[model samples]
Structures are given as structure tokens and as C-alpha cells.
Target: MSLTSPAPPGGGPLRLRDFRLLLAGAAAGQAGAQIALVALPLVAVLVLDASAFQVGLLTAAETAAFLLIGLPAGAWTDRARKLPLMIRADAVRALAMASVPVAGAAGVLTMAQLYVVALVTGTATVFFDVAHQSFLPHLLRTEHLVAGNGALETVRSSAQVAGPGVGGGLVQLLGAQLAIVADAIGYALSALFLLGIRVTEERPEPVPGASLRKDVAEGLRFVAGHPLLRVIAAATGLANFFAAMLMATQTVFLVRVLGLRPAALGLVLSAAAVGGLAGALCAGALGRRFGQARVIRLSALVSAPFGLLWPLSYGGAGAVLFAVGSGAVFFGAVVYNVAQVSLRQALCPPRLLGRMNATLRFVMWGTLPLGALAGGALADALGSRAALVCCAAGLLLFPLPLLLSPLRRLRDLPATATAVTAVTAATEDPGRAGGTPGTPGTSGAPVGTEAP
Candidate 1:
């Protein structure tokens, strides 16, 4: 129950009851989300007979909250308890999902209804995720971050392996709308697991006269001013934008262009998830052996080129190409994520963790709606194959920030931020303490000096 105490030696944080319960909650939520990823679109495309552009709009609506409420949410999270927020978010999503089946049964479900559901659920997810990231530092020590993240990623990958297959089966058997009933159940289950967690946290003292705008600006400055965080934002922003494009288009591409059934589509995704499973298992070892920074760069370099295979995909045999490309991308992404996220947690002061994580999520994920719109427009105008090419090409560009920045100059990054010097070229003076435009008052606890 005491979060500050160290995990038992050798057993690590996984041995703790609360951490295991937390992990179980995450696993359940992830599985449910994955199922919805497949089911939601299937309902729109198959049941509602929506167009490619409409599907893109649906995808856009799902992620648009990151841009809409992301900043205020971050400020609010910094002032609140993470666990209870996450529980509430999950409960909200469960109710939202359960509504789909209720509406469907009453014969009132529509694409418009689907859009509202996506927006509401997605907004809840944004809060849940930010709080979840903030919650982990309280749950485990810095040394165990990578291991804990890797374990969680393993849970995610395992869910990926099973979720799509299960989702597809449910859709085939019970209908897509009813399939979402399972996702609702899953969220409720995740909330139950969260309730069982017993870790108590001391809330950070309130900053006197801390306005939302000021708090958001401080978070922005922290990320924008830090050398490592700057590149991470840029690289991930690029990757997430393109990844959204792919998400916006892939279901349409798979169903329309390849002429695959929903069941086959799910199976293909499940097969691709095997690579993610491998990546999750290997992330910690690769980070340790190759050095965390190096592992992030190398994984992307080695696997991204395989994505080019996607545009060249043709028929049943070409389905193999799409699967291979997807698998490789997922592998590289999981490896890069485990290393970088751990690094971020280690480097950030605990007081700023919510804001820091929120800023990253907004900048990185905010592009998703625009990218989804673009992908949909491109597919409508140029065809899905060309859209696929854009996805692959964009994946290759994400590493440019890393490859060109000072991150590449190092072997392994330091474990703590106190050892890092604050560096920025964003303002008129390249080396200013906090170069955030429009942010007033003294530059916050200078980059990396705040207590964890």
C-alpha cells in the first residue's frame, strides 16, 4: 500500500498486488479497445454502409478530443488523483459502449450515433490514458519503469493477438453493435481491477494562482525546451500522424481493395500482432544490451523499410505483404515505445508528469484528426494503394528527428534528468532557460531539476 517503498528484490514490481491489479485493468481495457477498433468500423462500414470518407470522419472524431480537451485535461489531471480519474473515465466509456447495443436493439442506431459514441469514448480514453501514465510512477520505482512498461506492453500485445479474432467472431455471430457489448463489459471489468488496487498517493501541493493557461504553458515549455523531449515530440508527432492515416484507411483498404471479409481481416490483424508480442518480450533486453537510445533508433531503421511492401500488395498472396508490413511496423513501434516512455518517466519530475505526458499526447496525437481527414481525402481522390504508400513513407520519416538530434550523439541516456542540461533554440536566444512563447513568470524548475 506504501508506494514509496521498493519492490521486493528479484521479483520486481510485478510481485506487488496493486501493480498486478493495475496491470490487469490495463490489459482488460486494451483488449476492449482493440475489439472496438475492429467492431466500430465494421458497424459503420458493414451495417450502416458508410463510405471511405465517412469512415475517415469517424476516425477523426475518435481522436479529435486530443486536440479539443487535451490541454485542459492535463492541467486538471495535475491537480487530481490519477487512479480515481482513470476509473471514472473507464466507467464513462463502458456506459457509452453499452449504449450501442441498446440503440441497435431499439433500431435507432445510426452513423451519427456512432460518431457521438466515438467522440465520447475517445474523450474518456484521453483522460484515462493520461492518468494511467501519471499513475505508474506512483506504482513502481524508476528502475522498474522499463520492465513494468514492457510487461504492460506484453499484456497489450497479448490482447491484440486475441482481441481482433474474438471481435471478428462476435461480429459474425452477434452482430457488430452487440459485439460492442463485450467491450462495455471489459471496461467495467477494468474498473473492478482498478478498485482492488490499494496504493495511496500524496497529492502534489497546489500552485498558488495556477491558471489553466499558465499550467498548460509550463508543460509546453518543458517539452519544447528539452533537447530529448523536443525530438521525441517531433518524431512521434510524425509517426502518429501517419499512423492515424493508416488507421483511418486500413479497414476500408482491406475490405474494399483486397475484397476480404471481416473475419479474414481480423485474422490478418491477429497474425500481425505476433510481431508486437515478440517486440514486447524483447524490449527490455534490447534496451539493456544495445542501450535504450540506440535501441529506439535501430529498431525503427531495421523494420520501417518493410512497410514499403504494403503499397505493392496485390491479392490473396499480397495480403501476406500487408501482414508482413503491419507486423514489422508494430514490432519497431513497441520496441521504440518501451524504451522512450521509460526514459520520459525517468526524466520528468513527478509534479509535472501529468502535464508533461498530456503535452506530448496533444502534440503527438493532435495530428491524428487532420491526418485521418487527409487519409480519407486521399483515398477518395487517389485510391487506397497510394494512401498505403503515404503511410509507409511517413513511417520512414519519424526517425529523422532522432537521427539528426543530439540523441544520436549519445550511447545511453542518463537515468535521471538532473544530469541533463536544459537546451533550446526555439526563442531568439537559443540557450534560454524556458523558451515557451507567451508563458509568464520565472522559468519553472529548470529542465530536469524538479524532484521526482
Candidate 2:
């Protein structure tokens, strides 16, 4: 369970007990989230009789925390033991989600209560996700990062594949309000699984005179200064904005425009996520064959055009088009995510992982609330189908940032940030350079290069 210890006889991060525990916890948590993804909006639209704008606002509430507290969460995550933080976050989310069912049973559930629960759970999720990503390096070797991330994504994608179907069924059988009880139980189970992880993470060393503002600023500077990271952030942020639009409006379109019931809606979502599961399965192999940089670039470019199919979708047989388009986009997204997230983790210094992830999240996810609001407004002004058209257009444009960047010329990403810095420095000086970028004689070995 120690950081430097060898993996058990089998290959991959799964061979490690701590990693298995972490993966299990993630699986449980993601499954619950997927269920809530279906149940929450249904409750708002169905039971609460919320308008399109109101539903959009509720969706916005779920992600607003990333914009509000994202940077500071990273700094705080770095300063504490990540496992404990993750555990506490799960507990907080469980309590928040559990209240919904309680309120529903008491005949007191309202849009206001749902908003409060969403906001509270969203805040907890910000902390949990930051700590979770930061904690991975502590349990696995550098070489294992891709496989580790791939495994996590696989579990997440699997949950996405199954959870909504189950959630929809639960809603059909037990109603939306009662269906959320599953998410509460899921969070509680995730906390228990995490409690079983045996790895002991040491507290991060305190920096002298390090204020929260300074720490936040340092993380931002690092992300902004990195050429590839900046481009990745931009691409991801842009994609997320449109994705948020889809999230905000999809339920309305499915129910009002397409006239699908809760059960059928879940089936459609599960089908869409099948592509994400496939992408997660293929990510590691694709990275090895096509190169991570190429995969990152091509994944979005090739699949994004399918998003145009979303707005074109109609009822009955035409609904299948929505699933097809969504599946293709989800596939591309999962592959892009696995490759880029592994690259970021490999490139960052351990001391800065929390802040680095937090900063990037703020940039990428901060757009979500705005996009949700936009989607809602569009749905009100034009219609759900029109809102989807705008979202599809935005998705088609998402890959432009990556395509315009140096990633277009590279096969693999740089081994580390230090290697990138060295190359940047060398490129700037036409008169002096002796060693190759990753060679020992260069600036230094890649900052986070680890023993196999």
C-alpha cells in the first residue's frame, strides 16, 4: 500500500489493493451520480412542475460550485490528506441527497429544497473530485497512470451505461422523488469503500507565507503558462459549455418534444453512454497506437460532427438519431478526457497536483452554469430543439483550439512539463543548445519521471 511499493503479481494498477479500493469507490459514486442525473431533473420537471428555465437553473446550481470555490478547493486539497477529504465529501453528499427523499415522503419537497440539495452536493463534489484526481499518483507508478485512468473511466462509463436505466426504472416504479434514495445510498457506500483504502497519505508540507490567494494564483499561472495545457483547457472548457446546454435542455426535449416517458428516457441515455464505455475501453490502446496527442486531437474532430444530428432528431424512430449522435460525442469525449487527464497528471509536480487540477476545472467547468442558463433561455425563447442546434454548433467548434495548437504537429505529448519548458527555452535561443529535450544533460530530467 506504500507509494513506492511494487504492484502485486498481476499487471496494472488494479493489482494494488489501495487502487482497487479507490476504483471501487469511484464506481459506486459514479453509479449514484448517474442515477441522480436521471432522477433529479425528472423530479424537477415532473413532480415539481418546473419550467424549462427553472430546470436550467437547477442544473446550473449543480455545477456553480466549480466556478465559485474551485481554485481554493485545490489549494485546500493540497494542504490536507486527500483521502480524508474525499471521505468527508462523500458523507456530505450522502446527507444532502438523502434529504430529498425525506422531504418527498413528508410531502414537503419543493424546487427550493432541490436547489439547496443540488448546490450542497455540487460543492461537496468539487472537493471530492479534486482530491480524487490528486490522490491517484500517490497509489500508482507513473507508468500505470494511463491504465489507472482508463480503469477509472471504464468504471465510470459502465456506471453511466447502467445507472440511468436503473434510475429510470426506479422512477417508473417508485416515482422520481423516491428514486433519489438510491443516490443517497450510493454515496454512503462509496464512503465506506474509501474507508477501506489502506494507503497512508502524508500531510503536504506547508509553504512559508502561502496565502490562499497566492496559492490560487500560482496554480492559475502554471496552467496559463503551459502551452499545451492552456489549449487543452480551452478545448475542454468550450466543449463543456455546449455539453452543459445539452444537459439543461435534453430532458425537456425528451419529454415535451419527443414525448418519451421516464423509463424510455433512461434507456435512451444508457444507449448513448454505451459509446462512452467503448471509448474508455479503447483509450489506452488508441493512445499507444495513435499517440496520446493524436488521439486527443482526432477524437473530438471526428466525432463532433455527429452532434449536428442532435437537433435533427424527432420523435419515434427519429429519437434513435439523438442516441446515435450523443453516443458518438460521448465516445470522443471519454477518449479525449482519458488521454488529457493522464497527460496532466504525468506532467504536474506532486506538490501542485491539487491546485493544477482545481485551476483547470475552474476554467473548464466554470462555463457550465452560463451554458445552462443560456440553454434555458434559448429553450424559453426559441424552443428545446433550437437550443440543441446552438449546442451542436458549439460542439463542432470545440476542437479548433486543439487543432490550432502545437498538438497538431506532435505525436506524443511531452514526457513532462520540465521537458516542455526545456524545449521552449531551446527554441527561444538560436545560438546555444547541446542536449535533447528529455536527455539528462538538458535543463533536468522530466519533473515527475518515476522509477518503473
Candidate 3:
């Protein structure tokens, strides 16, 4: 696909210059972060002799950052210059991550320090993510959002497949502290790349009597009232919740039950990651050929059933079989996710993008902790295989909300644009103090009327 392609059927053209730089920066930064995700806890355990509970606490801290800052950060992004916010977030992550190496060099690495680093990096990441997605429309036209989002999925898939192996090797060779240096560098480089991009957006002129709280509330009200958005949120939340359960249980099942080595586990996950990339690459083509909604539904239908195959393969060579199954599941997940993201982005007005994005992510990821907790408890009580089986069953059935909603009956992206517009238009000025869109004689205010 040409990065500078013309406006798609319903929207504006792709901003090749800005999108490419942002893509590069995002890819590099994500790769670095994924690598550290594995290395950090290992560093705490091996270098500092931290307990298992401490390691769990570290994970909790990171997730808590998402839960705490996601919505507010989204609100903040909507109200600010997204690019500068993104740049600052990257800089903060870079500095915070660099401290890992500094502490290690001084022979003073501690569990507390690791948790702090994770918290800071994760919080910065929350802000960067909200800003980045919100900023995309300003750079690219409406039509190109699908392809642009596809390109991003490609980067994320590649990172997922490669980052872990690279991180493990780096930790072995350079030590965990020095290994983190790469992440710090990646963040700095990402910021530098973003600095080179230039794009201007129309800003809301403040009403002499405007209220910031009112502006934030407008975003909240928008999210709460949209039907399609609500459906999307429910479907995604269910999917993420079940997926987290499987992930939490997989390692133990592989090592203890399946008797796979760490290397084998890595290999299986890598295969899945590559499969995820393949699925993402196919999303645009699939949407074009089969129609977006159809493809999404079909993928969702198949993903969970196949995901079950992993736990069933519990003997010798179970590792390889589980890996293959994982790859299939990942592929299906990519198809579903890319289509969903494109749909949501296409539907939302640019002004409300940050809060909408944040609210969606917060709700979707919010279930992760519950899933993790359940997985742990189930594994201890019923065994790891049973826990995974439960996850697979949940996944197979999780798409009920979307399937039952108007989503199943829909076909192309264009068909849903009206619903998106109405929903977004209703929230444009939350301060209207009246009925909503689709109400008798109620017309949405002009787009871009809401203060970011």
C-alpha cells in the first residue's frame, strides 16, 4: 500500500509523511517496552532476590497505571496538542527506563526500584497511547484510517514475536540492566522521530465562559450514550478478559504439565506472534474482500474454539501442538482486532477521539486483572489444564454481545458510519443539557464543536 494513498471511499487521504514517522517511532518504542516486560521481573528475582508476591505486585502496578490514568489521560489528550504530549510521554519513558541500568551499575537494584520503573513507564505509555491514536486523524484523512491502523497492527505483531527472544538474549549477554539500555534508546529515538513530523489540526476556540470539567464530562457522556460504542466495548472486554486468563495459565501448564522447556515455550509463543502478524497483514484485504463486519464475526467465531486445542495437547510434543494452536488463535485475534479498531476509529469524531479511545481501552483492559486472578485461583484449585479449558470455553462464547447486536447484520464499514456519526454528534457538546441524538427533532451540533 502506498503510504500516501488518496482518501478512501468515505474519508480523507493518508498522511504519508507524518504517519510513517509515527509508525516507526511507535514500532521501535513498543519493541523496547515488550522486551523489558519480560526482563524486568527476572531482574528483580535474579538480581534482587525479590519474592513471587513482589513480582506480582510489579505487574499489578503496571496494570493499575492503565486503570488509573487511561480515561483522564484521554481527556487530557483531547484537550492538548497530541504530538507534544506524545513526545513528552516518550521522553519520560526513556528517562524512567534508563534508571534501571543506572541502578544496576551501582549494584543497588531493588524490587522497589523495579516496581517504580514499571509504574512510571506504564503511566507514560498510557498518555502516549491516548495521544497517538487521537493524533492519527489529524495526520491522515478518514478513508485511510483502516490501512493506517493495519500498518500499526503489523508493527505490533512484529514486536510481539521478536521482542521476547531479543530481550532474553540481551539479558543473558549484557545483563538485565544493560539490556534495558536498548529500551531507553528506543524511547529517545521514537521521540526524535516524532519531532520531525508536522501536522496541524483545527482547534476549538474557547468560549469566554467555557469550563474544562464540562469539556471532560462531554467526553464521558459521549462514551456512556453511544450504542455501537457500547457494543464494541462489551465485545472487546469479554475477549480480553478470557484471553488474559489463558495467558496467565499457559506458562505453568507448559512447564509443569506439558514438560516443555522455557526455550520451547518461547518458540511456541513466537510462532503465535508471527501468525498474529500474518493475520494483521490480511485485515485490510479481508475487509475489502469479505466486508469488514463479516470478516470480524467469522474470525471471532473461530478463534476461541481453536484456542482450546492448546490445553488439550498436554503430553510430549504438546508444546509444538500448543504452539501451532496458539498461532491460529493469534491469527484470528488479529483479524478481529484490526477490523474492530478500524470500525471504531472510522465512527468516532476526531475531537472526542482521545477520551473515546481511553474509555474503550480502560474498559477492555480492566478485565485483565480479574482474568489473571481467576486464572491463578482456578489453576491452584482445578489444575492448569482445566483453567485453560475454561478460558477456551469462554472465548468461544464471548462474542455474543456483538453477534446479537446490529453488528452481526451489518456488512461494510460505510453502513455503520451513520450510527457512528449520530453517536459522536450527540456527545459533541455535552453541556447541551437536553435529550440525545436520534431523539425527535434533535440535531447534533456541528462536528469539532466540542473542546478537544
The TM-scores, one per candidate, come to 0.92, 0.93, 0.82
Error of 3 at 109 (Å): 2.8
Q: How much does candidate 1 score in TM-score?
A: 0.92
Off by over 4 Å in 2: 1-10, 416-452
Quick one: ranking by TM-score, best first? Answer: 2, 1, 3
The per-prediction CA RMSD against the true structure, in angstroms, equals 5.2, 3.5, 6.6
237: Cα error in model 2, Å? 0.4
How would you order the candidates by lDDT, starting with the best? 2, 1, 3
Mind giving the per-residue lDDT tens digits that candidate 2 earns over 129-177?
A: 9999998976777778889999999999999999999999999999999
Candidate 2, residue 232: how far the Cα is off, in Å: 0.8
Clashing pairs in 2: none
Give the Å shift of residue 221 in candidate 1. 1.1
Q: Which ten residues in a row have the lowest lDDT in candidate 3?
A: 439-448
- Candidate 1 lDDT at 280 equals 100
